[model samples]
Target: MDKGMFWAVLAALLVFSLIVATVGGVRDAIVGYVMQTSLQHAQRDMAAAAVRQRAEAARQRAQEAARQREALQARTLAPDQQCVSGTVVTVRSNDASQLIRGGAPVRCSGRLAEVPLR
Candidate 1:
């Protein structure tokens, strides 16, 4: 080959290699950016799910507490029913009852046998 032709071929080859390397670098950068964005979106979704779970738990707890309160209210007793000592108030039939402690209305079904019936 002629010396001039060899030099021209060499120059063209160098330029082509550089272009290929630059394109490869750019592709890598774009892929990395996409991966980072996807990671962030996944993290956000996970956080949202955690928050929703906590909310559901709280709601369940509140519902349970309300059910317990209703059960307690249903257990209130009525007056004139005979009761025995340590006859807890849940077995009674009235709403008003003798104070068991510190003026606290006994809202149970049964009462102490010896205690005066309220």
Candidate 2:
């Protein structure tokens, strides 16, 4: 081939190679950007899910505490029927004998037995 034609062919091949490389690089950059965005979205979703789970757990704990408090209140004896213990056994005014024994009010007769310490 003539010198002029050879030089022209070489320049054209170089330009084509450069264009191919640049296109490939741009495509790779686009793929990487998409992957990064997807990862970020996934992380955000996971964080939101964690927060929701914590909220649910806190709500459940609050409900359980309320139930326990209500149960404790229900177990408490009335003021008239309840009596303080000297030490050994604690008794509530359930009957006339128990009221006299516990030194509780006569209105508390036929009450249920309850022990605060135990």
Best by TM-score: 1
- Candidate 1 wrongly placed segments (more than 4 Å): 78-118
Q: Model 1, 17-54: lDDT tens per residue?
A: 99999999999999999999999999999999999999
- lDDT by residue (2-90, candidate 2, tens digit) is 99999999999999999999999999999999999999999999999999999999999999999877665644544544433422223
In terms of lDDT, model 2 sits at 0.64
**Candidate with the greatest lDDT versus the true structure:** 1
> Which run of 10 residues does model 1 get worst, by summed lDDT?
109-118
Off by over 4 Å in 2: 83-118
